[model samples]
Target: MMLTKEEERALSGEYGEALSQAMRILVKVGEVLGAERLVPISHAHASGVSYATIGEPGVHWLESLVKGGAKVSVYSTVNPIGFDPYSDIIKVDENFVKGQIRILEAFEKMGFDTSLTCTPYYLREPKPFERLAWGESSAVIYANTVLGAFTNREGGPVAVAAAIAGKIYEAGLQVLENRRTDSRIRLGFRPTDAAEWSAVGYAIGERIGQGIPRLEVPPPPRDHLKYMLAASAASGGLAMMVIEGVTPPKTYLLGEEEKVEIGREDVEHMFGSVEDADLVFHGCPHASLKELVELDNLIKEKVEKEVWVAVAPRLYERANDVIKSLSKKGVKFVRGTCLVVSPIDKMGIRKVATTSAKTYFYLKRRGLDVWLVRLRDVASA
Candidate 1:
């Protein structure tokens, strides 16, 4: 691969140890992937922020970069942490707090924007064709498919390297040829809610795993689409999905791509089985302001069971009144953390109900019994 004089200098340590190492990481990744050159990125969203998930090794690695005087070179943000920074709806043990604080300090040292949500696209809107290095799988799919931006499903360290260097290798989804839709998915029914959308997404993902699948159905609302793609990625490792009307046509080519049809029965089968739930969770990718408001309305008649709504701090602030009102009615608001990353088992939340298919899949792995339900019907369930 050819490199400009500045890039070569950075890799050779002229830019200081931290940046030099970061440059080396990106360069090596580029070489491995056969990327000829590095592409400038408009943004970078780092994942693995939760202490409960990343633990000591993650903290140590991040601290080393901070001690080396490392900082992001471009607009960058972090994923959700282990707990809410502003509020304490969920309990945290002493050991968890000690480690979580260290991780937070390291992130702050690197100048990561504490928007602290999986959905960085909500914070810094990506222009069509803009390049980004984002870690969260849901965000990666959304950026590529919905916003018409260019990015692969980068890992935590790779995204951090891109942040420090302000660039990433121009390979994978960054190239137009690689973004081609390889298969078509025909939907028999339009998903009426997040649960149905998630079910359909799961079916498509199970049938067509990695490559792009063009949906024949009309585009659902952005909010619904977010949940659907999140579930698909969780269930079947989908990085990019092409919707017939939603995805920008010019970004992907569709020629002789295999076609598959998914019916209502297939979607129902993917919904999984759990009749009753002890607790309800929302916002696997972090709730949007609109979602928070809708949740508030849905829980007007408080039930015996606890309902946890996880959201980004920015969204919490934006929808302050609604969230506060819901809290009064016995709804719990968790900031900067979702059930998937946080210690749900520690909280004694064994039986759970949620609208996110992604959350259902993950919590189940932890041995929690999760019931899949739509947001509107959650109260009745």
Candidate 2:
């Protein structure tokens, strides 16, 4: 593995033994991945720190970085499992809270902002085409694919180390060559619809854990693109994909008339049947302004209804005035909790109905009561 000047210097005992050990691990990782250089990332968001059931490695490593006097830019955002101030969506056990605070306190000390949710894209405001290094599996995929942001599926400590060193090991998605699509899976859907696209992503990702795909779908609605990215990131572990005739090479490389056809049944086989949920959830990746607007529109017509909903802090700020008006009518706007990370039974929420394929899978892994509901149905009810 190639090492940076700073990394070499650390090996020579420049940044102290502890720092050297950390950088040594990074060097080994870079070597294994065949990365040639190091590139500084503008932002970061890490996941797997918020443990509802057991240990949180995210918290452990972050505290170490902070105690070691790690440095990071202020714009960096974090995704973790935590409490929701507004809604009773998640319950943080005492031990989990201690771990969370220790990790976050470290971040705070190191000049990082704790966006503190899985959906950092919705909480931390960044324009399209911005580059960030995120560690959370789904968040990395969501930020890079759906939002058009740049990120590689990096690990938790590497994210902190990237922040501390003001750079990341050039590997996977970081290199332009690595970004090329090695394999392709075609879709018969629309990149325009967030929900359908999300469903397709869920279906495909469940089947192909690490395959880079090219999607061929029908023309879709505006919000559907969000879910397409969300579901794929949620299920497939996909960090990025090129929409056939829409994304870069697929759209640009093919001259006037060149498209491949994939069967619809192929799409169905990607996601297995999931049922038995009690509450409906959206915004697993982070609710965008468009989705929030749709939610506002849906709530206006809701009469005898109560669904556990969570949104991003960044989106919450953008739709503040409107959400304030909606709150008077009865909509629980939660800031820092997700259905997957929350203690459902403690909140007295035994069953959950959701449109998110990612949420459905994660919840089902816990052996909880989760029902799959269409987004449109949740929109009305």
Candidate 3:
């Protein structure tokens, strides 16, 4: 792979050891991926932040980078941690809290925003063709498909490196020719709610696997689109899906792809009832402010069952009044964390019902009985 003089100097340790190490990682990755050269990125979002996800080794790695003088060269943010430091709704051990704090401190020391969200696009909307180095699966797909930004499905460490280097390889989704789809998905029925949207996405992912698909459907609402994108990425390892009218023209190309149709019956069975759930959760991607407000409007009085809503700390602060009102109505706001990353099994949350298929996918793998439900049903229950 070819490197500019500045990149060569950084890789040769002319910069601090931390930056040299970061540059080395990127160059190795670029070579392995057949990248010809490195390109500058506008933003970077690193994942694997949750204490439950990474444990002690991950914490030590971040601390090592920080100690090596690693600092972001571009605007960067981090994924959700194990739990919200500000909220007491989720119970965790003292060790867990201590480990989580250490992880957050390391990222902060390295100049990351510590946004604690999988949905960095919500924090800063990327423009069309903007270059980014984002780690989260859902966020990668969303940025590529919906926002028309250029990025690969980067790993946690690589994303952190990209933040330090302000550059990624000119390969994968960063190359426009690689954005073409060879598969197509046609929705036979319209999704009525967020749950249905998620179900559809999950089904599409299962059918297509990692293949990018051209979606034949009307443009979905922004919130619903997020649910679908999150579920698809969770279920299928999808990095991009070109919507019929939603995706920006010239960003993606449709080929003579094999077609698959999904009907209402195909997805309806995915939505399980909420009758026997121990906990009702929402926001696997972290709820947007609009979603939080909609949830507030859905519940008229205090709910009888335990209901938790995960949101980014910034969004939680912005919608403080709405969150407080929802709290009075028995809605617990989990700031900066979601069921997928939080230690829910340790909390004895066995039977989980949520509006996100992505949440259902992860929690089920953790030996919990997870089911999908509509947002209204979650609020009412």
Compare the candidates by TM-score and give the number of the best one.
3
lDDT of 1 by residue, 78-148 (tens): 99888777777677888888998998888788988877899888888898899999999999998888988
- What TM-score fits each model? 0.96, 0.82, 0.98
Model 3: per-residue Cα lDDT at residue 327: 88
lDDT of 3 by residue, 258-332 (tens): 989988887887678778999999888888888988989999988999888888899888887998899899888
Displacement of the residue 200 alpha carbon in candidate 2, Å: 1.3
> Which scores better on lDDT, 1 or 3?
3
Candidate 2 global CA lDDT score? 0.61
Candidate 2 residue lDDT tens string, 192-265: 33444566667777676665665555435535655666667776678877664334332112223223444456
What CA RMSD would you report for each candidate? 1.7, 4.2, 1.0
10 residues in a row with least lDDT, candidate 1:
267-276
Off by over 4 Å in 2: 11-13, 16-21, 53-60, 85-89, 119-131, 146-150, 182-186, 189-193, 218-222, 244-277
